[model samples]
Target: MSWKLQSVYMGMTDVATHNVLLLLKSVMRQCANIELNEGGNLLQHSLWVAYQAQAAGCESPLVVAALFHDIGHCLCAGDPELPDYYRDREHAALAATWLSRWFPASVCAPVAMHIDAKRYLATVDPAYRMQLGRGSKQSLENQGGLMTEHELSAFSSHRQHEQALLVRVFDDAPYVGECLPPYTRYERIVRSVMR
Candidate 1:
């Protein structure tokens, strides 16, 4: 199915929250079969990340960013034109572009920078690169391996750099079999912060 995000968000001034939630629920349900690392399926990983964000005492926007950070994977999976590696290299941009319509830069900026955050961490923390999952390791190669000193310096200057790094921590953590609340647990939190 062609997912027209604009159509989904159109003409609802005050109800962007509800509409965005519905859009997220629809995507999650439709993409339930897609695996996201050994951590689990897409929904499971998102929930775990979001749970970690909340547990870390993140504000609502950061929690939402964690929940939706990898949504571009699902979007790319549905597209026949995009290659697999494109999903890895471009998913963050895809998700951030779509989410920018409804969320402030505080939320979307970190989502956009998540892939770079991984690369940054890999460069700064040698052990971080070793701990990556098979998929992430492969994607790291596609995402330009480790960041160069110049790239690292530029990425560090972004206002949301710290938030992006925090999200990256949750992204790399193994969530499967760990105790995490159900996806439903964050519905209210997501709704409250939407738009």
Candidate 2:
């Protein structure tokens, strides 16, 4: 899709917020290469994840997090430097950190832990470990398993674990229909959360 980000602040309350949106727009313009499955695009992938997060009963913060989880891909230029790709881990932490001012920790927590959660799952569940994609597996092998108690402790403390898992599940869920339909879903989720 043509990533023509209309340079409009619409309802943005402050300059900082407007700037962040501009940043997103700029990144979208540059990241035309990202493609989602079956004629889908990065925008669709983002919206779908947010849509499903709302449908799956995720709260507002989590829903928002789902929507912007991959925004960092545009800014950081494809997944921030991390130790593992074995589980398709990326720059979730960096994204989460940047989002902190705009969103609550409850929201950013899952976004931040998205990568570590994959690593945690890999270590705890062999079945899950087996299902990881090639990129994930390669990263896991290269990074080795979640081998420290501190890492395990950190993953455990994240209150967004369940929500993060929900986001993860939908992130890869089948996109069976037109992407336009999901936009409404995303809107509804965001509205519900904001309420």
TM-score of each: 0.87, 0.68
Best candidate (score: lDDT) = 1
Residue 180 displacement (Å), model 1: 3.2
Which regions of candidate 1 are displaced past 4 Å? 1-16, 37-39
Q: List the residue pairs that clash in candidate 1.
A: none
Best TM-score among the predictions, by candidate number: 1
Model 2: ten consecutive residues of lowest lDDT: 1-10
Error at 22, model 2, angstroms: 5.0
In angstroms, the error of model 1 at 116 is 0.3
Cα lDDT, model 1, residue 145: 90
| Candidate 2 global CA lDDT score | 0.64
